[model samples]
Target: MSVTAITASTNSSSVRGSANATTNCLRLRRSHILFGTEKRYLSNQCVQNFRFTKPSNECGQRCIRVEAGWLFKGGGEQGSDARLERSESANEDILIFFYQLDLATRVQYALNLEEYDIAKQLRNKLNEVEAEVIKQREMKRGSSSKSEAQDKGISLLRLRADLQNAIENENYSLAAGIRDQISKLEADSLAATIKAQAFEKAEFEFRLGQKVRHKKFGYRAVVCGMDPVCCETSSWMENAHVDQLTRGADQPYYQVLVDVHEDPNLLVAYVPEENLLAPEEPDKAKFDHPYASFLFYGMDSAGDFIPVKQLREKYNRPRHEVPYDPQQDQTGDDNA
Candidate 1:
């Protein structure tokens, strides 16, 4: 009987403990349901507020919360989904700024290039101006040199004219002095020319028995027995015989001969070597006959042979009685 009573007591206590556990579980379930509903309402309000606010107004708040959540996730906070979105936007803004800055730099560079081109063109123009200035300077130098040469020529011409006037007026002393000056100038100027030509002035001294040609006379013997007083010295002169008929009574019959070629018979006056020149050859057709030769031959009053053209002229007169026929005796003498 004692064991049965103890068992009954244990059963009752177990039932009471089970009933209290069931009540406590039901209350806990209700409290959890109420808490879940409150959480859902808070989530909906947060979504609404995020959607209604302007991007400029909500960006800061949204970024803060999103960033906090991303950090809590701990998958490299900067590279997380929400953080990546913000970084992309920032990158776009940076790209736009760089593009604008690049465009502005390009425009400035183009303007600088244009200025450089203009400067190059100006440099070319300056070079042309410098070349023109050099050309003008050279031309001026040439003109000045020409002017100086012309002035010198004019002075020389005036001096020559003055000397000529003095000579014409027979101012012997003045003319001589001026001539000397002119000669000196001419010698200075012609020094190189004279050296090149190897020319010499005429000397008064001459050799005896030397064969010389003259202007009027053809050829003759040089007789050196006679004496004549000349400008420089006494010269052994050339003498030639002339018929008395050919000479005038007042004329000096024994004329001194200088150049034999001027007149073979020494009929003409003696001329200095400075003034002497060769005579021109006669035309062959004009005097080709024996009569022409005879006309030049010498003869005396009594028909004697004399070494003179005057004697030939006095005796051998032109035969007017005869016709000028090639077959006729042109001298009108039929003695042959």
Candidate 2:
């Protein structure tokens, strides 16, 4: 069982009627099973009950139970290891992202200071990070590169033809191998087709470069990319308590660039659709993520980030026009 230690103090009066009476102080430490992230804290009233009138040293340390019901709550006693492993994995992803952000920031600083040598080295590292991000995305989808529909169809047909020839030649072993390959190719093709349909239907709730806030964590972010459903590994899903979400892992997930001003530790977050909300008003303030300049052109009048051509192309997204605002135009004129 998951546990958290809490200490409470109890007071005792010895031989109350005697002149030489002395009071004894006893400290009690209790362990409670911490279930979910949302409600981990024990209340003051719960702590106060630990103060016993007849305090005993033997009872100083005891184990208690708490009914934890929140998002990502494990199923039972066996879930502890899964939860722990998941947490460690998340930490690794965050650390890697942090390193990339640091590199990008250093590259920008070097350029500003006219340190060409340092900037070149940092920029190279930043490029590595960019490539890694793309590779990781493809890995999640079980593909090395995005292939066109015609290419996939043609490949499948060629494999099937090879399988047929092998079978006709009485090459049983070769035919079996070809048959397995054909099955795998068909499965991949089907998955790709479904994903394409999802995109074509516009199933995503948020658009690329749109500003949003996390409903639970309340951090401001901009949508960078999205999946029809969570594409993270099983271990990552367990650690993130993705199963605990209202819509579960079957719902859309977004790749968001978090506002560094709000949370420097969290520069990027893969969040669920239900957890994101659009801002009621346009926020024209500067966003401080390192990837902001790399992935986007600039903020528009509506306070939304304008995605760069490359970023839009990567996600097959169309160009977005900045909403016209007379007040913004007037402000620009006044500044001029």
**In TM-score terms, which candidate is top?**
2
As a whole number from 0 to 100, the lDDT of residue 143 in candidate 2 is 50
lDDT scores in order: 0.28, 0.58
Q: Write the per-residue lDDT of candidate 1 for residues 229-307, one digit (tens) a residue.
A: 1211112122222112232111211112222222222221332332223223311111111111222233222222222
| Candidate 2 local lDDT, 1-336, one digit each (tens) | 111111221221110122321233323111122211111112321111111122233332233333332222222343332222222222233334444554555566667767676567547646755676667656454353235444677999999899889989999999999889888888877777665555445477888899998776666889887777677778778778887889997778888877766655454577889989998888777777766776778887788999877667666778988767798789999999
lDDT of 1: 0.28
Clashing pairs in 1: 215-279, 217-262
How well does candidate 1 match the true structure, expressed as C-alpha RMSD?
Answer: 65.1
TM-scores of the candidates are 0.15, 0.47
Q: Each model's RMSD to truth, in Å?
A: 65.1, 17.8
Model 2 segments more than 4 A misplaced: 1-196, 199-202, 327-336
